[model samples]
Target: MRKIRNSEELLGQGDIASRRIVLEIADRTLDRLDSYRRIRSIMRMEGSVLHIGTRSWDLSKKRNVYLLGAGKACNHMAMAVDHVLGDRLTRGVAIVKISEETDRLNKTEVFVGGHPLPNEEGLCASKKMIEIVDHAGPDDLFIAVISGGSSALMSCPIDGISLQDEIDTTDILLKSGAGIVEVNAVRRHISALNGGMLAKRIQAVGAELIGFGISDAVGSPATGDIAVPYAAYKSTPIGPDPTTLDDARATIVNFDVADRLPKSVVDYLMNAGPDKETPKAFLDNTYFLLNTLPDSCIYAKEACEEMGIPAIIVTSFLEGESRDAGTFFASMAREIQSYGNPVKPPCVMLSSGEVTTQILDNSSIKGHGGPGQEMTVSFAITAAKTKGACLLSIDSEGTDGTTKVAGGITDSSSLKAAAGKGVSLYQSLREHSCFEALSAIGSTIFTGNTGTNLCDLNILFVPAIEGGR
Candidate 1:
């Protein structure tokens, strides 16, 4: 694993030791919980026996093994699978966001695609994926690598829905602060391969399908029911039923995303047809969760302990507005400084899970930042002038929103540094321009594609004693 590129700059600007500790924890967590490493740890091939978690597959019984995957982490995960299966793997294709960072594979072809929104490249790649799967026979094995951005990266619009329609709908949902469940539900209905539709396609050819899901959708009730190392044949279908469609419509209305939706989207939703429904049943399919947010948080906590720093995971299922959560954590740090309750100083606080940023309508605001950066700025504002506290928030995939930077790291001096540059933190937050504000203070966290996505990670470091005490 590569070091976060902006680590030095970030550490240089904050309370040096505290920032170092926070970065160390973040780097360690990233290293241990990397998607490829996690996959490699659980999978191995010995002669004809292939071991994946607790289950073993005999190569003698299987023929024509094809690998298909998509997501920010699928490149690494696919590479790992190729290494394990070696020549036994027939052929594969993986859609990823970064083509440059992708390692060469013997049998797997890596396709660079768009994220957060699907593009022409993703559409093309998804078509190739469908072609490959559609050719599978009864004796074939289809291993599907699913992860965080798969919904966007593997986009193949269903009939009557153009790529533009999907893009418009996605943009609306993202800006509306809709959760993954609702967003994915809407996507599953419009796409040709989401939900259980992929399984349905493979079943048509009598091929056996298995899903390796690295869950970025933490706290989802669906994840809890899945048995570890067990292949689930049944997947919840997202169809155009009255209940599901109503929920989808309600989400758009509730979030005020309806106005931005394209005419095609509105027409499709309003004039629902059975063709838009994803198949609920499949002949042969199974699923397993490879990694999750709590899994990564546990790794971070363990790493902190290994460094002799007392660490506690405050929560692994954090959600809600990003700024609110940021302010709350900053307040917690201040509380720790003023009083020794809830574990004293010299400890690291950890949290994981996705958060949302409700961007208010501002046509003039052109800010480059994500929810992670927003949280960092909010923390800087609330924790100003308070010494011995450092906080770092990052999207695990290394890209926060559409910005080039991952997120931001800040200390008590962060606000002072921005003030020195005549940067107003409040104005930045108001305009949702955290990227520029943190960049000016040399606090932006930059890591070019960490090759993994398991939600977001936030670390707070409180020193043993306050400054000047």
Candidate 2:
């Protein structure tokens, strides 16, 4: 705990208490995320569905454990699965979005695919997964691991459209500011592996399927049922910004590949019909939500309060488009500095949620940034002369995008750093290079992998000003 001031009343009544409560809840939520660790904790000798903690369950006698992972924690989940089921893990395959691949699977094979959009790699990976699923027998166990970035990473689209079409649709939805549920709704339509599509395929193969899910969305249902086709169906009114297409193109490939198609995914999309099925009812053995954003929000809030600063948790979960959310947070921070409406001086405002960044296409252009840190940096630059105001945002899983740093942090030094480099803060922000801007100034927070995934956390602090602003 980093106490920045002195006042028990403020500690108990004001922002500190609010922040502490939020962080406490966040921490408790985080405890559930040890599910991966629990999988590792339970040896094959342990009973079926052995409980390690609340919501953390494992099965030792899962005849032939098959690993199917997609998300930020996919590799971690695979590692944990391999650690426990070593020889028992007869086969494994997981996909990470392009450039999002962090760790190599311990005993499992890992594949880097696509995200925010699908690409050639994603298609190939999907084919490989289908092959693996096709091989599962009745007694063989299929552990389907899913997380936030699964849609793009585990994509296997319908027959007529190319991966590029999927990518274009994704771009439209992302720019529209549609929520994950809504985005995934349309995504599930053309995607062969979305909704319960993958599970249905496994069922077709006669494999006993068990799904392990980690929710980045606010409410974690059985399997993000509402998320499958929500975005495409209910695209947000948010219009597009003038962003370069080069960045997005940099990691994608598959304007046109082949005329090949998996009969299962294609038939499922058509025969099962888009509107004919519910999204999440795909896997019978399902465990949703190992950790979530609210959990991280509470934990960070508490830690802020223990430091003696005033803190308030305005929202337990925060979600939406990355840039828009960042700008909104900047306004809230400014308010705390000037008027002190929601929270007073010497305090921190904390929140958590999954944020999506519109991956721009780039050829000659070059930049780097992620939702978390970019939000913080952008907020700091937008600060209305609140000299001591500091904001920190981080992705709980350690890596933010393709970097080692979790995200960005901002304060007076940010302005100084920008000025020193002879660059305007606005320019860095406009370039969408907040990650590098902060990293160059040595302001990015790095916490490799906390062995937990709790969405994202945002911590904002306002030190006592000369006259309380």
Candidate 3:
């Protein structure tokens, strides 16, 4: 299936050659990262045995097999497991950021959970999952498929903290300019499900847990051998957490969000002792690492190579302010086109990581947009200097923030196009309305539930100058 839904429209305008190359590479890379296909390839059933990666579970020996999942990509991950287990699966519950009609399941109950923030549906689903785990005995087995965004999608706050508190905390931290690691540190410490609390719950009930996870943490190294059991798996609701109470406290102070956050949450984290800390390790559970943030860049590089285009994986650890990053990428494009500093022209620069947008005052906001949209808009302003320099920035899982589109694609002509359409890209960036601006110029990219969540996937295509560099 085509991942980029508006490919034809995108190709009809602005640096068509560069847009075509970027879209093709992105589509192919997204296909390669589909968790549903990856899970199905490694998991199967043979009579009474369940085979997942290098391990096999004897379902006949177990009393019940339950599937529990939550994440942006949980739809695909959980569907793969639900399809394989079929009748053997006692029950399944999956919380996803978005639920589509294409999803097929027999026993699993799907919940459309909120991402970037927790919602009532996610809270209800979390309670149900807790009930299932708490009822489980030593004879039961659990298969957990977890990915990024599980923190918000599987929201269950600890004692004294209301669901509103969690939501407010998330909203505050996200706009505070703190990195995801910092945000998750505070979030995981206060949550009942995230930061390995679900695994801890399963452990308390003496249930066997085998987890299939995709680590979307920025700077995470590329995954090796998906078939081998990964021992270092951490974070999410299904695995042990590396974040500590100290880390949580440190984040609040570092980001200076202590005064703004809910007082109940502040008191809990401040006074909670060693007993309240999240589980740091799960020695008994089995985990398999699927894909990581670095894998996105690696896959994109491979896609470019397949098309005979030289690609440079500039960095998979891209972070910082979104608009600023776009400006930097545009500057790099200029260098590559003019001086050929970073591998010369006719090359693709691939990068993946979580970039954030800071919004201190909600009243200043005008329209909808995310970090990826902001980045491309910012790039368009400066990319006007470099001819044929095209850039594509998408959230990778399809939705880029408030907009339904994945992200935006822009090139040298984008600035002119926006000016002609009476869409002020500068005003859009100032008002944080990149989506409206990009949409007005026919530059927005759309691909729903891409089956992978690796933060941001940025591809910059800098074609060689008209003549020799």
Candidate 4:
């Protein structure tokens, strides 16, 4: 459903045909990856047997079928499961971010929670989920739905560790520029439900569990190197790998987050015993990866080709500082214009991955924006007068960081427009407050909640005709 709310206004600001093509690609990508649509195609009941991906379950043999999930997109996933299970669904619960979509589910009990950070509501929801898993029996089957934001959306602190401690630790790690893998490594150590702990809890009572996940983290190829020549659909397990603890410790020390972490967090990590560690494996359980960032990127590329635009899947594993990545893309655009290298002009260069922002320590720099916005602003500064180029940077979840705005879009005229408004684009980037500056130039994008998350999508569109600007 109209995920990009300001599409008409946004398209009006840039080269119309180019904007339409890029936005259409985004729309089709989201539609192709919609949780409900994907779940329906992948999961179905054939007679008494429920089929999910490459696995099947004999529902006739189960005592009860329960649904449990948490994430920004879990509500949609839950709804799809509820419809599929119908009256056979005994009970269901999902912890979701607070949004207009909260009350849409009828069968599943949906609890509103915080995102990007855990709050009391999430804590309460976590307790309910734990109770559900704790009460499950061997005859029961749990269909767990996990997606992006599940780590924070289902925050259950370990004993002796307060919610405040978990919150403080999360804030420190996020601001410290730790990637999701590293942050989740630490989270698995600190939480009661992360890693494979949830599976452990379910299996402890001899209950059967199967997970359907929309992966937001970069996947591995077993060799530990990033998977290359990205695949549209791939499945992998979720758990605290054997190396998780060591990685978490390294991240904390390497980023110097230990000193700034809460005392409880520090003590837990420092004194973490084998008993407190998340298990590397959960026996007799299975997890299926339904979709991912790479999947969406591939879909976008196919859409671009259908529209007669040569598209390049630059990299699906984009990472590092947001402004730096923006600058790099801006430079690439310049190169394409000047030398016609990198697939020449009139091509769409697409990349998918989460970027980071290193917030300044100075308290006076009170700016609010997410990595996507910062990236767009940075690109605007670098590609100030470049012609026939437009960039759209957005977090797939439709909410970039703490702001309601999804992200920002920048065209060749973006910087000029900002200047006309007497706004300093570079100053805004320096303050990490791009929302206001982008808003001043009608570049801020708004999409309430896209009902999905697969990291961020950055689209660089150069018109098919040279000098289109």
Candidate 1 residue-wise lDDT at 166:
94
lDDT by residue (1-469, candidate 2, tens digit) is 1111111222232234333433343333344454465355432334355332233334454556677777666766666666665565677887764333346455577777765567777788788888887776767777666666777777777676677767766665554445555556556656667655677677776776545555566653222332122221211001011111221221121221112223342344444432544343332444433444465665555555565556677675577666677677777766776777677676677777777765444432257777886676677666646655666677766567556666756664467656776756566566767776766665665555445556677777665566656
Model 3 vs truth, CA RMSD: 0.9
**Global CA lDDT computed for model 4:** 0.78
* Ten contiguous residues minimizing lDDT sum, candidate 2: 234-243
Whole-model Cα lDDT of every candidate shown, in order: 0.78, 0.57, 0.92, 0.78
How do these models rank on TM-score, best leading?
3, 4, 1, 2
> Candidate 2, 275: how far from true, in Å?
7.1
TM per candidate: 0.91, 0.72, 0.99, 0.92
- Please provide, for model 3 over 1-469, each residue's C-alpha lDDT reduced to its tens digit, 9 standing for 90 to 100: 3788889899989999999999999999999999999898889999999898888988999999999999988989999999999999999999999999999989999998888889999999999999999999999999999988899999999888999999999999999999999999999999999989999999999999999999999867889999889988875788878889999999999989889999999999998899999898888999988899999999999888889999999989999999999999999999999988868888999998989999998888999999999999999999999999999999999899887899999999999999999999999998999999999989999999989888899999999987634
What's the TM for model 4?
A: 0.92
Per-candidate RMSD, Å: 3.1, 9.5, 0.9, 3.7
Give candidate 2 misplaced runs (Cα > 4 Å).
1-35, 38-44, 47-63, 97-106, 219-283, 305-310, 320-324, 327-331, 334-340, 355-366, 398-405, 446-454
lDDT at position 381, candidate 1: 84
- Model 1 accuracy (lDDT, Cα): 0.78
| Candidate 4, superposed: residue stretches over 4 Å from native | 101-103, 220-243, 360-365, 464-469
Steric clash pairs (candidate 3):
none
**Top-TM-score structure, candidate number:** 3
Per-residue accuracy of model 4 over 414-442 as CA lDDT, tens digit each: 88888999999889887778888888888
- Worst 10-residue lDDT window for candidate 1 reads 234-243
In terms of TM-score, which candidate is stronger, 1 or 4? 4
